[model samples]
Target: MRGVVLHAPGDVRVEERDDPVIVAPTDAVIRLSATCVCGSDLWPYRGVEEVDGPSPMGHEYVGVVAEVGGEVRDVRPGQFVVGSFFASDNTCELCRAGYQSSCVHRVPIGGIGAQAEYLRVPLADGTLVATPGTPPDDLVPSLLAASDVLGTGWFAAVAAEVGPGKTVAVVGDGAVGLLGVLAARQLGAARIIAMSRHESRQALALEYGATDIVTERGDEGVARVKDLTDGLGAHSVIEAVGTQESMMQAIRSTRPGGHVGYVGVTHDVALPGMDLFFSHVHLHGGPAPVRRFLPELVDLICDRRIDPGKVFDLTLPLDRAPEGYEAMDERRAIKTLLTV
Candidate 1:
């Protein structure tokens, strides 16, 4: 089997690796059908995140179950499934409370890496959701998106309590933020403001039902959003960039008492406690409980209510992952899809 491995920053390669097998009674082995590169992958690619040795890379995946452990009864071999980036025993207290990302037995899929021919998923019954059946060829990408970005965006919208009659602001124009705009619209946000400087992404945001687009940066961006909202700021703000600047923008663009749903994989960030205390803004974010929203997102994708795959502007073979990384890092592609 072949998988993507990062030897070091600026060095990603596809090399032969041993195929994964069911190692636990709660585990399942999946033969990946599709996978993708995430924005967070760039951290290591750009040398921002340290990598001491060869490490597998990828989390978002849609695949067919090749085998299942003895304890995994719900998901059987040959079933097509989509799973959250974080694997969790859905019966845990946190999972039962709808926070599977924080489950007591949770395991992050990226740590194991899904950008390969096969992946071993822990807590199989809890983490993997079987699709209606083998979906149409075109629907594969959408289902794959549900495994991460779509689910994260949906979680962000829910965290912010976005719904009818509320104004929502989305910071960051990456795939997750773009999907956040879509989530806001589906959640009944009356007005969706997507803050982006990229024309292409902004256009897609509009197509996804964004009511307005702000092309400014930093304070100017917040001012534009406030101006559009009559100086009250948005009722809900989705922060998808996971950076200091983007976080500040989200907080500033949101009205007092408004909610901020941040789903970006936080890197080096230090929140100002005083500012947050004074602003009276509510903040909620961490690894998204994608499992909590998996069922609904799967139904939406199956019914074609949303086309989250639009985020993948470029598709490449799994072996060409290096090019995929370069394209995304160079801003030449919004997201990259890898076909196994």
Candidate 2:
């Protein structure tokens, strides 16, 4: 088997590695049909996140089950499946409440890496969801999107309590943020505002159902969202970029009684208690319980109700993951899909 390894910042290499195998009764080994580089992958690659040593890369994946452990009964060999970045025991109390990302036995699959031909998925029965049947080739990329970006965006919308007739705003124009617009539309929001300075991302956001686009960011961005909402601010705002400015912009762009669903992986962020205490707004979000929405997302993709795969503007073979990373980091591609 071959997989990419990150020896240091800006350094990625694809080379032969030992094949992954089932090591737990609840584990499953799947031969990846497709995988991709995530926005989060750039953190370590850019040295924003510490790279202790050579690290395995990738987490989003869609594939066919090659093997399954004895305890994995929900999936079987030959079945095509999509899985979340974190493996969770769906039976846990947290999972039952639709927070599988924090399941009692949750495991981060990033440790094993999915940018390879094979991947060992823990908590297989809970983490992996099979499509209605083997998906057609065209639906593969959309299905892969459901495994992460789509699911995360959906979770953000839910957390923000978006509903028909409500005005919504998205703070970032990245893949997750663009999907947030799609999720808002699916949830019946009356108006969706996408904050993006990039014309390409702005176009995608519009196609995804955004009614307006705010080219400014930070304080200016918040004011723009408010201006469109008649100075009342949007009813719901999705914070997809985990940055201090983005977070504050999201909070400031929401109505007093509105909600802000933040799904960005936080990095050295702190909220001013005085401001939040008087904002009179609802706040919720973290690692999205993608597993919580996978089943429905998979169905939507298979039915062709959404085209999230368009996020993957750049596609390359798995071995060229380094180039894919560079493309995304350099803003040359919104997202990169790696073919196995």
Local distance difference test values of all predictions, in order: 0.94, 0.94
lDDT of 2 by residue, 96-212 (tens): 999999999999988899999999999999899998889899999999999899999999999999999999999888899999999999999999999999999999999999999
- RMSD (CA, Å), each prediction: 0.7, 0.7
Each prediction's total of clashing residue pairs, residues at least 3 apart in sequence or on different chains, is 0, 0
The residue-level lDDT of candidate 1 at 148 comes to 94
In model 1, which runs have C-alpha deviations exceeding 4 angstroms? none
* Model 1: colliding residue pairs: none
Show the colliding residue pairs in model 2: none
In candidate 1, where is summed lDDT lowest over 10 consecutive residues? Answer: 277-286
TM-score of each: 0.99, 0.99
